[model samples]
Target: MKSCQCYLFRPPSIMSISSWVCLLPLIFYTCLAVGAKPASPQNVNVLSLNTNYTLTWDWDYNSSDALPVSFTTEYIPRFKLSSKRVVVWNMACEESPRRSCDLTPLDLHYLSIFILRVRANVNGSHSDWVQKKFCPDTDAAVGPPSKVDLGPAGGHLDVFISDPLTSANISMREELQELYYHILYWEKSEDTQDLRSRSLNSSVNMVTLPNLKSWTWYCVSIQTRYDFYNKFSSFTNPICMQTQGTLPWWQIVLYFLASLLVFFVLMLLILCGSFWCYRIVKLTLYPPIHLPKHFQEYLQDSPSSDVPRLLTPDSESELLCEVTVCPEPLVLEVHQPPPEDLEEPHPDLEPDIRHSRQDSGGSNDSGIYSTGGSSGLRPCPSLSHEGGRTSCQDIYDPQQVKMKDMTPGIRSQLIIDEGVLDMSV
Candidate 1:
C-alpha cells in the first residue's frame, strides 16, 4: 500500500545539489562559446579628393586572441536603404589586412549619396559592420587650382586660372559643377599682409586686375572653393609677373617728328651732292679754246694789211758781190754790124737808155745788155774794138721791172747791181 501510494514527482535528495552544481558550469560554458565574437570596426570614414575615394576604419583587438585580424569594406547607395525589397551591399575590400581601402575603382557617382561600412573578422567569426554616409560632391574636399598664369596688360594684370584635377587627371569642375575661385594678389615689393582678395564666379576662368602700377612686379595665388559644402582648398604657389608700362602721347609724337626731320635733311644733302657731281663731269668733258697772245695782237693791229707786205725780209740778210781780173792784157776784136743793118733807136727811148746806162754803171763788157721793157729790144753796135774791150749801152729802168714776176736769181742780181757793180779789164 505504501509503494502504490508513491507519487510521480520525487522528493528532494541530498546528492542532487552537487549534480546540479556540476551541470550548471557546463551549460554556462556552452552559452559563452556560442555568444563570443570579434570586436566591430570603429570610426568608419570616407576620404575623397576630386574623383579619388578611400574608405578607412579603426579596430581594437584583444591581446589574448593571438590570431591575426582582417577587415572588410562595403558600400551601398543610401537610397536603397528605404526600399521595400531586400538590399545588398557591394564589396569594396574583402579580407584586407590594411585599415584603408581604395574605393575609386567602384566609380561611384559624385552626385549620388552612398553608405560606406567596415567590419573585422578573426578565426571564422565576424563582427558587426560600422557605417558612414558620404556624398562626393558635398563631403569631398576641393583642391587648389591645377595651373595659374599671368599676363601683363597696359597698367593692368591678367590672371588665368585652371580647375583642379584628380589623380586620374579628371577635372574637379566636372564633378562639382559649381566651382569658384578665391584669388589673393599683392605687389612683390609689398608685405604679404597687404594682400588683396578677389572672388570669381564659377564660369569665369580669367580676371583682370585694374588700377595697378605700371612696370611693377605682382604675385598672385589662387584656391578653389565650394560654397554648397563650404569647402575651401589650399592656395596654389605664388606666380610672379610684371605690369606693362605705356608711353605718353607727347613722347611718341616727338620721336616721329625727329625721324621726319632727319629724312628731309638726308634728302637735301643728296640733292646738293648730285648737282655738284654733274657740274664737275660737264666741265671735264668739254673744254674751252683760247687764241695765242701774239696772234691776237697781230689781228688787232692791222685789219687790212697786204699779204706781200706782211711777208717782209728778215733783218739779218747780207748781200755779197765778187770782182774778177784778167791775168794778161790782151787785145779784143769786136765785130761791128753796119749802121744800115741795125734799126735806129726811137727818140723817146733815148732818156730810158741813158737812165739804164747810169743804173748799170757800164759793168757789161760782152756787148750784151738788158732793157726793162715788155716788148722787143735792140742791142747797140760796138763803138771801138781796142785794148780787148767793147763799149755797150743798155736801157734799164728800175721802176719798170716787176720784181714779183721775175725769178729769184734775177731779182737778187738786179738788186745787187742796182746798189754797186764791179768790172774787170
Candidate 2:
C-alpha cells in the first residue's frame, strides 16, 4: 500500500477576484501558510473518594475553526509522596474533539490524584501538561479524610485532624447532615470493652473494636473527614500484642482427676495405718496369759513321796520346800537363806539350841545341818512319807542359815506376804 505525504506551502499575497476563481481549485488542495497556537484549557479537579472509586471528565470540540483534539487520561499515586507512580489507560477516543471517559476501582493501593489533559493536534505532536493539578485530590466540599493512623488493636479506631468541625460521624454513606469532622478511626479486630465503657458521643474522635481476645494484636485505620464516609489518609505502622492462652476442657478434667486420685490414695493409706496401729495396741494391752508350760502338773501331789528327809528327824518336821519354774527361766536348788540373816541381832539374847520344826498347819517342816562349818551348811526338804526318825539332835539353829548357788540366767523376784506380817490394818 502507498501512503500520502503532507507538505507545507506559502500562498501569494495578491490575487484578483475573478482570476482567483481559476486558482481556487489549487488553493483548495494546497496547504495553509501558518497555523495558530492551541488554546489553554481550564483546569479540571480530581475528586476524592472513600471506598475504591473513580472520576470522569467531560469535554467537547467547541472551537469552530480548529480540528478535534485528542484526549489522554493520566494518573499519579500518592501525590507529593516518595512512593509516587504514574498510571496510563487505553481510552483514547476521537469524537467531537471531546473528552468522554471513565475510570474506576482505582487500585486504591496506588492511585492517589489524577491529572486529565487534552491536546490539539493539527499534526502528530503533543502539548505540555495542559491541565496540571498540584493538589489533585483536594476539594472543600468533596474529598477524602486526612491524617489517618494505624493501630494493632484491630477493633477500635482513632482519628485526628488539625481543626475542629461542627459535627462528626462514622458510616458507609458519603453524604449526610451538616456534620463535619476533625478525625476518624476504624477497628479491624475483636473488641472486649463495652460501648457503654465510653461516654455518649465521645466516640467522635476515638473508636473501639470488637470480637477480639484480651491482649490480642490488631490493625486499625483512621483519618479526618467532611462527610461520614471517605477515604482515610496519613497512616502509621502496625503494632502487636500476645493474647492470653486458653486451656482446653480435657486438660482441666485431667487435673481434677489427678487431684482426686491423690486424695483417695492418701485416705486409703491413713485408714490402713490406723488399723495396723490398732491391732498392735490390742495385742500389747490385753496379752493372752497361759500357765508356765507345765506348772499345773506340779500342783497335784504324787501318789507316793520319794523326797529326802532332814537330819533333825522330828516327827512333825517333814516339810518339803517347793520351788517354781516360770516361762521366765529360773534355777532350782535347796537350803538357801537371805543375806539379811548374816547381820547381828539386837542382843535381846537367849542361848540357842536346836528346836523342833513343825508346820502350824499341822503338815510338815524340814531341818538343816552344818556340812562342815558355819559358812557351808546344808539343808534338805523332807517328805512326810519318808517315815524317818523324829526329834533328831544334829539339827542346826535357824540363825545358822548359809548362802547358796546363783543362776546367771535367772532374775529373782521376791513377793513377800507383807499383809500377812501386819496384825493391824
Candidate 3:
C-alpha cells in the first residue's frame, strides 16, 4: 500500500474591508427582522386543579396604532424536547383573544411531564414562544373537599370530609399519596371572632370536636391539603349544624314508655271502632221479622180454640117451609046419548033410580047427581036438558074432601073430575 500525504486547508485570519461592507447590510436586515417581530408573552404560568389545566401569560400592548394582538397556546411532552427527532406540538388554543387557555382537553397524564408554550400574534406575525414545565401530579393545586358533613355525637361534633376527585373520578389521595384535610369551624353568629381550626393527618378523613356547647349552633368548612406538594385548597362553603346535650338514662326510658303508651291507646281505639262498625254492618244486612199486634195476641190467647173459628166464615140463616095439599073432590058429569044409541033400562037399576028421585023431592034443578042415605051415598039431583041432550054434573063440596098430612119435604095436590084423576107436586 502506498502512503498518501494529507494537507488541512486553513482559513484566512483576517477579512478585507470591502467584504465587511458587503456583509454589514445583511446582518442589519437580519437584526431588523428579529426586532420587528411581535413581543413574546411574559411571566407564562401553568395552573392546574386536579387534572384540569390552564395556561396564562402576561402581555402588554403599549402602542394603540398597532393591530390588536391575540395569543396562541401549545403543549408537547417534555421528554421530546431532548430528542433530535422532530415532534409536533399540540395546539391547545389557537389565536385566542383571551390571555388564558384551557389545556385540560389535551388529557395530559398526571404522572407525565409536559411543556406548555404561549406566544403573541399581531397582524400576521408571531413572537418567540414562552415556555413552562408542568407535572400535574406535583404542580396541580389540591381542590377543596368534595363533600362535608357535620354530625352530633353526645357533647361532641363530628366533621366528615371527602377528598377531591380528578376528572376520572379518582380520589386525589390515591394519586398524591400524602393527602389530608384542613378544617375550620365557628359558631353561627353575626361575629366570626370565635372561629376554630384543626388539621388532620393523611390517614383519617373524620375529625371530632370535643367539649362543644350543647343545644348550640355551629358551622364548619373543609379544605384539602397536600403536605408533600405544599398545596392547600380554598376552604369549602360553610355548613351549619346544631349540637345536642346528652340525655339522662331515666329521661330516655320515660320517653320510650310514653311512645309505647300512645301506640297502645291508638290500637285499642282502632279495635273498638272496628267492632262498632261490624255490629252496624251486621244489623243493616240482617233484620228480624215481627208479627202484627192483633195476630200475635190472637195466637197467644188460644190457638186450638181459634183455629176452627178462623176457618169458618159468617152467613145468613136459612128458612124451611112445609106445604100441605088437600085431595080434590070427585065430580061426576053424565051426557045423554042419542035416541038411536039409547037402550032399555035394566029392571033392577030402575027401582034404585026411582027411589033416589023420590028422596030428592024435586028440589034440585042444577042437574047434579049425588047418592042418597039409602045406600050410604049423597043425594042426587034431577037431570037437565041442554041443546036437546040430557046431562048431569055432580055437585062439588069442599067440606066433603079430606086434607092429608104431608111429609116434611113433600108438596102435592090430588084432583078428580069426570072420573079422571091428576096428582101434582
Best by lDDT: 1
lDDT of candidate 1 vs native? 0.70
Residue-wise C-alpha lDDT for candidate 1, range 215-253, written one tens digit per residue: 888888888888887989998898899888877899899
The TM-score, computed over Cα atoms with residue i paired to residue i, of candidate 2 is: 0.24
User: RMSD to native for every prediction?
Assistant: 25.9, 25.9, 23.1
**Residues 188-237 of candidate 3: C-alpha lDDT, one tens digit per residue:** 77765755554434347878976678988888777777777688989899
Lowest summed lDDT window (length 10), candidate 3? 333-342
Model 2: per-residue Cα lDDT over 55-154, one tens digit each: 3354334642555466555544334335445444334233224543333333333214544454444444444445434232333233333333334443
Off by over 4 Å in 2: 1-30, 37-40, 51-62, 66-69, 76-100, 108-116, 121-128, 134-425
Candidates ranked, most accurate by lDDT first = 1, 3, 2
For residue 254, model 2's alpha carbon misses the true position, in angstroms, by 59
Off by over 4 Å in 3: 1-36, 60-70, 186-191, 194-202, 213-217, 248-425
Which residue pairs clash within candidate 1? 332-388
Worst 10 residues of 2 by lDDT: 416-425
Candidate 1 lDDT score at position 213: 88
